[model samples]
Target: MNIPFYKMHGIGNDFVVIDNSVNSISLNKRRVKALCDRRYGIGCDQLIVLSNPKNDLADVYVQFFNGNGDEAGACGNGSRCVIAWLYRKYHRTEFILQTNAGLLPAQVIDSQMVKVNMGQPRTKWRDIPLKHEADTLYLPLAGEPSAVSIGNPHVTFFVEDLSTVDPVFCGKVLEKDPLFVEGANISFVQMLDRQAMRVRVWERGSGLTLACGSGACASVVNAVRRGLADRHCQVKMDGGNLIIDWDAENNEVLMTGPTSFSYQGSFDLDHYPL
Candidate 1:
């Protein structure tokens, strides 16, 4: 079977999006990995599968898979990309997407811009699902990073200078730390001011991507909890900037950014083994 897909990106975090709403496609770990291989397939940081919604309130069900073929609970950047794709297809501005994490509400701000309500940040140790109970605000780690869950687990380390830290080294070492029962995305943040900060992320499954939406959200939440930043701030990543607003009144984190449509193509499923 030849599966058609759309290549899209939010900021610089790119994904191969497949509309499986008809339930005609079947994917497994091997196929997912092959499809995400840059050298061997339609390379992307992640692969997004859109299926018919199981929930009445949802317009579609979005499932995210990492480059390694692991299913992710949530992906903020990918979510925006999915919403943008839906908007283009259905010509609607507002949408609700169901994921493994939960229901996410999104709106198309414009042709290239989108905003997603990433739900609330989970701060408890159990929710972040650390090995045991520990202070989420300050985990017992080398950098004393703070942990938060925005549908996915993330640990943010605030540094005075981002250049001083090697995100690749730290992310690889800390992502699988015993402290995190499930691996976590590692974010190194350098605060430029109360309203802006520079961020570098080591994503859980995709490694060093250009940007990470959940990481940005988690970083700002941790920063605000530590009183280092305000509720609304700009998260500057290598790919671009994302506006994150932690609405205290609604306890929701709003992520706004721009998405790009790379191209559209199809690949033969027979080329990749199940």
Candidate 2:
């Protein structure tokens, strides 16, 4: 395969990106899953594929796949990596990119910081795709989780004790539950202070990672609806922190964070090597 890749990260959430625009790099689910295996492949939490826009509506289009090869609709962290990779190519600080979810605007805020406009979230029950719609904006599911759609479906549960909630256990069940046909990212959130929160997520397809951006945004939405915090807040994940803001007028949820570059390399095609 001899496919070239760049390793990038957002708040310690890293990815291996293959530029399909120039490489024609294609991997079956088995190979992509293997490439994400820490001990066998390139060792990334996920693999991001960058290709030319299918409809020519944007500069580029991104494909996000978890370590297990499930294609995720959106990935905030991977979006930063893809943008950073493009910036490095043109030596520009800002750019516009597209994804399976929607178009995203990105820029290098500082030497090592990047900001991304994730677009607005849809709180409609159908948008969140919860079976038997009943106002997902403040969805009072049986388990009492707040539902929102920011590129993907998310059900945020406010926990009294962050440690008491086992995200992996609960997330595992909720992700598969028929309520969410395509599955979803589940977040257990605990308000740390007026301005901060402790969050853990069970991401769809990927299970648990160091962090999940949409999870943070959804958490803030849930927290605000529950009157647990103000509209603007900081969400602390296992890997790091993300800034989330809710714009009522625009009906948008904005998340800010950093993306990092780790290394550049290539792999042979005949085998998926770690």
Candidate 3:
């Protein structure tokens, strides 16, 4: 069996995108995991399946999955990549896409740049799906973790230095700690200045990854709530930099970043037989 795909990336975070709109392909957990395997398949942090919108309310619907095979509600970078793919294929300047997280409005700010309205950030423990009840701005986990939900759950831990902390150890412990039932992307963030910070992520099911856009957005929102950072800040991840802004008046968060297309091709799925 063969399938068509487009490998795209934003910063260093990458995805394997399938045009399910035209191709009759169904993504099972095992097949998605197999395709994302670095050694045995096309390596990627997540797999995004793009299908035609189910109604006039949306232009596209994205099904997202972590490399570990768990279905994810939303992904910021993946959303941007999907928009780019749609823009490139459909030549549209603006569009609305439906995600597991909810409706997302996206537009091409310029060639290779996109702005995404990622909706509101959830700060309540119930909303973030954390077991403990408290202000999400300050929750006790392994370290200083701020629970915020952009599209999915994220625990942003602020550190003074990026080099001092060990992500492998911290990320593993905090990701599964009973606080977050569905697990969370752990972000160790170090403030560089009032408006900039360095971030590293142990993505929920993907483990350590180069970047996480939703994580970045959540971190800024947490920082602002805690008075650590302003409403607009730059989150520098391993992959690259992302600008996050929260509009208090409207209760919406906007993330802006650059996206890239690595290449386009069809793959033989025989190696990952379902």
Candidate 4:
């Protein structure tokens, strides 16, 4: 079967998006992994599938699969890209996207920019679903990183100098730490000021990527909790910058960034076995 796919990216985190609403393409683990393989397949940080909404309140249902073919609860940047895709089809600015994480509201800021409400950050150890009870504000780790669940688990480490920290080395070591039962996205953050910070992330299942949207949101939330940064701050990643605002009154995190359409094409499913 030939499958039509869209290549889109928010910041530098790219995705291969498929409209499964009508076709209802069945993608097993092997196919998902193959589609995300840089050398063999379409190549992307994650694969996004759009289907008819299961929830009445949502405009569409979005499922995210990492490069390793594991399903993830939520993806901030990916959500914006999905919204952008929908905007092109419906020509609507507002949308409700249903994911494993829950319902997310999104708005198209422009042709190439979008903003998404990532919902609330879960701070409790049990909510983050750590192996055992530990302080979410300050985990008992070498760097004393803070843990938060932005639909998915993430641990943010505030470092003094980002140049000195190797993200790949630290991310690999910490992503599967015994403390995180479900594995975690690792972020090393260097505070540039009270309102700006630099971050490098190791995304769970996807390894290193240009950007991690949820990682940026988690970083800002953790920074606010620690009084290291303001509620609304700028998170600079390898790809670009994102504006994250932790709305205290709403108890929600809003992420704003740019999205792009690299191209669109179709591929044969027979190339990837089940």
- As a whole number from 0 to 100, the lDDT of residue 108 in candidate 4 is 93
The C-alpha lDDT values of all candidates are 0.94, 0.82, 0.87, 0.95
In the range 1-274, model 1's lDDT, one tens digit per residue, is: 7889999999899999998975468889889999999999999999999998999999999999999999999999999999999898899999999999899999999999999999989999999989999999999987788999999899999999899999898889988999988899999999999999999999998899999999999999999999999999999999999999999999999999999999999998889878
Model 3 agreement with the true structure over 1-274: per-residue lDDT tens digits: 6789999999989999998888878678898999888888888999999887876799988898899889898888988998898899889989898998889999998888998999998887898898768778778754657898887898888888889989888889888988787888898889988799899989988998888889889889888887889888998988898999898898898889999999978888777776
- Across 1-274, the per-residue lDDT of candidate 4 in tens digits comes to 8989999998899999999987788888899999999999999999999999989999999999999999999999999999999999999999999999999999999998899999999999998989999999999999899999999999999999999998898888899899999999999999999999999999999999999999999999999999999999999999999999999999999999999999999999889889
TM-score pick, better of 2 and 3: 3
**Residue 270, candidate 3: C-alpha displacement in angstroms:** 3.3
- Index of the highest-lDDT prediction: 4
Stretches of candidate 2 exceeding 4 Å from the true structure: 55-57, 137-142
lDDT of candidate 1? 0.94
Model 1 residue runs over 4 Å out of place are none
lDDT of 2 at 259: 79
Q: Candidate 2 lDDT (Cα, whole model)? A: 0.82
TM-score of predicted structure 2: 0.93
C-alpha RMSD values across all candidates: 0.7, 2.0, 1.2, 0.6
